[model samples]
Target chain A: MTLLSALDYASVAVFALTGALVASRAQLDIVGFIFVACLTALGGGTLRDAILNRDMVFWVADPVMLAVAGSAAVTVFFSAHLLESRYRALLWLDACALAVAVPAGVGVAMGMGSAWPIVIVMGMITGCMGGLMRDVVCNEVPLVLKQGELYVTAAFAGAVAAVVAATFGLETGIALLICAAVTVTLRAGSLALGWRLPVYRARPPRNGPRN
Target chain B: MTLLSALDYASVAVFALTGALVASRAQLDIVGFIFVACLTALGGGTLRDAILNRDMVFWVADPVMLAVAGSAAVTVFFSAHLLESRYRALLWLDACALAVAVPAGVGVAMGMGSAWPIVIVMGMITGCMGGLMRDVVCNEVPLVLKQGELYVTAAFAGAVAAVVAATFGLETGIALLICAAVTVTLRAGSLALGWRLPVYRARPPRNGPRN
Candidate 1:
């Protein structure tokens, strides 16, 4: 497989793990586990592809990805109780998935001759969509919409990196690698150091809106 | 415009109103108003088109639906509090939109040569996705997903009406009208009469799984 496609699969698998863990916490059945896992793994890519008007949904076009995500869900369902800290694992796996998904989205848009801004936007969508869908389906306030979440920002930065590097005539492979690296660094840093964007505080009614 | 397209626009406007009311309750600013409104209006069509691999997203390809939704949002923003009961308005409007959207979705899938089951599924998706998205974003458990909720069931019945009528050689227009009538009757009746399906009872631990 191409490096980009490989990155896509890896990202999906990690994301599926996060989704299954959430389903388990909700005490959902095996069907819910698979459904959530597959949605989390493929939701972002599906949205990106549809918005970009790609011909087919990523997972629907390739059932192997669905199978892979299903396998991840099954594994997590059976073994989650054995894990020391599924929450921590979820955060780290999500971070890794975000790192890889950014370049995957950017690459697809870039390949389709999308403009730089659209490329970056698509990249961020790809990286954030899985978790957004997961939280939404599970009836939690989506983390992406929360005031202090740095996750979307990190994905945006990584997308911009790939777009900028490509503009400077970097090879596609090298540019994507830089994209993934920057994303992983930022996300991992956020987890390790409790980094956050400034929260948008609802100020006194007399004051203007939060930035 | 075709009848289906017209139904699409009408449903989008109504659904946007529901979304804007939710945003108003959350006390979001105008930007949030617009965002939530557009999402509520278009989320169902977007999901249906994406899953069906249609050539273009209904709203994205035609900016008119977005404009309609935006106009609805603005209207709700300014006048929501003036309404005697926004929640009641939301539920009724949502029911109406669901009625129209079911036929719209089933028509599109049928036009694309989808099987009857897929057509029914798509119809329900079209009917429910907007509200599902609105509730999720607004952090309310989706009404369609609530125990014994008749919302999705109503949509499904409408879709089945269209497919069955068409199967027996009904004209497209009549078939769609039949679909809409059935859906509206069931949904409106439920709202008026408090009709609901039986909630699945959880058996004792001697049985295998919950419900």
Candidate 2:
């Protein structure tokens, strides 16, 4: 529980940083910056909870979460101009976010007793969807949907590992550690090796219906 | 059933057309145009069905509905250039969309056995959420949320009327007609009279933690 709590805070902090980066790129005002940051931090979990029909979402249940995310956003907004290395900082923050978030999402879904495949899918979605939404709103091609590092695939692998370890009678704590290790390693490996999914563009159909 | 089908078709068509118009303004390519149109036509229903856990969404179950929406978008995209009064055309199209969509949403929710209040909420959400999403994606402020012509209010009033009439033993067809009429009339009245919701500004917090 302590380890999960730490990872949760790390994930939220990194996500807040990424959100601030996006808002800065868009040249948004302070209000827009906070709005985007909170959205990026809570959006994926909110969708997941809504889909699962949970009684109350994590942010809604605990106001402290919102406060922490908001504070992180404000801190980054004021301090971002002082940073010397921009792209490298953004990349490192995003990688750290993926490392922490994938396992957390998988852990929560597994705790909910979702089927293994569904758990894996949910983890991938939860880990990546918020960033994808932010990119869409920021008018960028979604990084995951483009030829990028194996982001969603890494989440899937981690979630599957966690589920499989649990099926082999591992303790929940041990399983979470394994999940986090798998997620971080796979994602970091992809970043180091420039690993990417194959881009399979749909071929225009012959004699396609005319517009 | 026949009237419901007609209304559904009309709503989907006009909504798709509106989306295509926005896509033009956004300078999206052909694929983006089609995607946005599809999102506008089916997005609300998809959210509703997903929330309700309904099996197989309507467009997924019936591809012809998508075809109709696609054709409507294509027609509007091409014909828009020929219109001398595009803004007027857009206003009328929006009015038509509201008239058809509000009652159709209420009818669908009630048919699926949702309680009165839930049905009313669903109706408003279904009628408004897609356009809100469309505007947000296009980077425009959401018209439904603005202090402008009473879109959600009209939807709510129509849905309540339909549910009340049904509760009082009115025929389903007549009830739907009354609901549709209420929505259309309310929307038309708001546009003519410049009716609007009061503006909402955030109030200063007392004794709140400051960052």
Candidate 3:
């Protein structure tokens, strides 16, 4: 199998694990776990393909991806109770998934010869949107949208790195490697070293009831 | 200028109003209002077009739909406080939008010569997904999934009505009209007359911590 496909599978598995962990936290049934896992694993890529108007969505083209996600969900459904800290596991697994997914998105856009902006946006979307959707659907504040997190910033920087590397005529595989490395490094830094961004601190409305 | 286009515009506008009202309740700024409005208005159609592999997303092709959503957001930004019960307004407006949107989805699927099941699913997705996204994003239990509510059932029944009408040699326009009428009547009955479907009542797990 191609390295790219391997990375895609890895990301799907990890993201599905995180999603099923979340479903466990929500106390969902096995069917709910599978549904959430598949949704979280496939949501970002699906949206990217849709926006790019790909001939077929990735999972639709290869049902094995769906199987991978479902397997992850089933595994987590039985094993999640043993985890002492599912949230921490979710965060770290999500970072790893994001690292791989950003490169996947960049590669697809680059393959399609999309403009730099579109390439960058697609990478961020692919890396971030699945988690965002999972959080939103599960009624949690999205990690990507959390104040002071470097999650989106990391994805953006990684995508930009890929674009810049490609602009300089770097090999496609090397550029994607650089993208993944940068993404994971920054995400890891945020998780382990407390890296942060400035957060919006809204002032009280001058003349309205507070929401 | 066609009746279909008119209905599409009406749905977008009303859905945008509901989204903006949600934003108001969420205490978001003007930009947030516009973002939520556009997302809520265009999200379902975007997913529909993507799944159907349309040449372009509806708002991307028309652009005017985005403008309509944005305008609704701006208007609601200044005026939402005037409503005594924003939630009530949201429910009614959402029902109206669902009525229009289901027919739009059915029309698109029928135009593509999709099978009956696809037609029913596409109609339900287009009518129900936007509101589901909105509520999920805002951290509310999704109205579509609310216990005993007829929201999804109404969309499903409406789509089936359209398919059955068309199969019986009805004109396309008349079939969609029937779709809209059925959707609105069922949704309105649920709202006004407390019509309902049986809800899942989960028994306590034989052995697990209460979620």
What lDDT tens digits, residue by residue, belong to model 3 across residues B1-211? 8777887898899889989888777666564566578768877888898889888777756767877998999898877666666778889999999999999998888999999999999999899998887887766678898889899999999999999999999999999999999999999999999999887776788899655
Which residue pairs come into collision in candidate 1? none
Off by over 4 Å in 2: A1-46, A49-108, A115-211, B28-32, B202-211
On TM-score, the stronger of 1 and 2 is 1
Winner by DockQ: 3
TM-score of chain B for predicted candidate 1: 0.94
Please give, as one word, the docking class of candidate 2. Answer: incorrect
CAPRI-style class, candidate 3? incorrect
Which of candidates 1 and 3 is the stronger one according to DockQ?
3
RMSD, every candidate, angstroms = 7.2, 9.8, 7.3
- List, residue by residue over A1-211, the lDDT tens digit for candidate 3: 9767887888789889989988998999999999999999999998888888888889999999999999999999999889899999999999999999999988888888877867876787799889888998898777775546678778988999999999999998999999999999999998999987543233354564433
DockQ of 3: 0.11
For every candidate, what is the interface RMSD in angstroms?
8.5, 12.0, 5.9
Give me candidate 3's TM-score against the actual structure: 0.61
Kindly indicate the candidate among 1 and 3 with the higher TM-score: 1
**For model 3, what is the C-alpha lDDT against the true structure?**
0.86
